[model samples]
Target: MKKAVFLDRDGVLNEVLTERVKFVNRPDDLYLLEGAAEAVAELTKAGFDVFIVTNQGGVGLGFMKERDLKKIHGRLEELILEKGGAIREAAYCPHKPKAGCECRKPNPGMLLDLARRHDIDLSASVMAGDHERDIEAGKKAGCKTVFIGEGETSADAKAPSLQAAVKDILQLLAD
Candidate 1:
């Protein structure tokens, strides 16, 4: 079985549009956070299958077209690969927060599907995100969780940022 690392997209892989307090609806709005590419590369090089599990409710809300979302993801993948990182797959839920979607954060549907598709060992995998919902999803999916940021969380571990989180996860894998 393969070990995997699931990551949240917005605050984890890229900067959230805090200025607008909304999602990155346009491809131009997408921006990779500092050190995110390098951190992902390190994890890939360490033999963990890397995947992105995110909630993009903006689509369901009609704020953005699906093609625009694809463009953003394309740019993201290009940037990561250019930086020597590999993303095994990306999964997202387009349902509104109140739509009761199974694949949204705080729900394990996406992670569970990824595990099944990739033959992943949930026990050996890790989920890293910046929100409580991310941790909740990982916990429910039976994977170790790493919270990337401060404040109270139920994650198994916490790191100041994605770069630091990857470092800690690698250390745990070594142990």
Candidate 2:
């Protein structure tokens, strides 16, 4: 089975905006957080297939469109490739908070789908993000979870930044 890394796109990949800004409707708005590219590069070099799992309810809420999301993701892909890393796939839940969709974080649906499609061994994998929901999803999916940010979580690990997480995870993976 293949091991993979699941990442959250917004606060974990880019600076979490103080206020949501139209859901990053254009490629121009898809910015990378400091060290994000390099952190991802490290993970890629460590031999893990990377995937992005994001909650994009803004699209469902009519704040953004699918085409807009595509454009933003396209730029994100370009940037990752430029930094010597690549994401194998990206999946998002476009349902609003009240929509009760299954793919949103804090739920294991998305990870389970990826596991079924990619022959993933969740026990050997890791999920990293800036929120508790991300860790919760990882837990439900049976993977090690890394939480990044202020709140204390029952996550397997915690770090201050994606870069720091990368450093520690690489060492752990090495072992």
Candidate 3:
């Protein structure tokens, strides 16, 4: 069985406009958050399977087209690769928050599917994100959960940022 890491996209992998331009509807709006690429690189170099699972509700809400989302993801991949990080795959749920889709955050569909497809052991995996839904999904998927940023959580661990979260994850993996 292979160990893996599942990461949320918007706030975890790239910048999220908490105060402005929240949707990241355009490719130009996509930017790697501080230390994000390097952290991902470290995770990949450590021999764990890394995947990005996100809920891009903007697509379903008509804020961005599917092609535009593709462009943003392409740019994200390029940036990560430049920093020597490799994302095995990225899966997103293009549904509105109220859509009640199985693939969205707060649901384990994406993680479960990825584990099945990639032959990953959910018990040996970690799911890290900045939202409660991310934690819930991870728990549902049977992986350890790490919550990024400040907030109340039932996550197994918490960190101030994605980079910090990765550091803790690496430490936990080593223990």
The clash count of every prediction, one per candidate, is 0, 0, 0
**How many pairs of residues collide in model 1?**
0
How much is 23 displaced in model 3, in angstroms? 2.0
The models' CA-based lDDT, in order, is: 0.89, 0.84, 0.89
What TM-score does each of the candidates earn? Answer: 0.95, 0.93, 0.95
TM-score of 3: 0.95
What digit string (tens of lDDT, one per residue) describes model 3 on residues 60-154? 99988999988888888899999999999989999998998899889999999999999999987899999999999999999898999997999
Model 1 lDDT per residue over 6-95, tens place = 999999989885774356887778888889999999999888889999998989999988888888888898899999998888898988
What is the C-alpha RMSD, rounded to one decimal, of candidate 3?
Answer: 1.4
Q: Provide C-alpha RMSD values for all models, in order.
A: 1.4, 1.8, 1.4
Per-residue alpha-carbon lDDT of candidate 2 for residues 1-175, written as tens digits (9 for 90 to 100): 9888899999888755755443466787777888888888888988888899998888988988988888788889889889999888888888896787779888988899999999999888888889899999999999888887777898888898888899666654544
Off by over 4 Å in 2: 19-22, 171-175
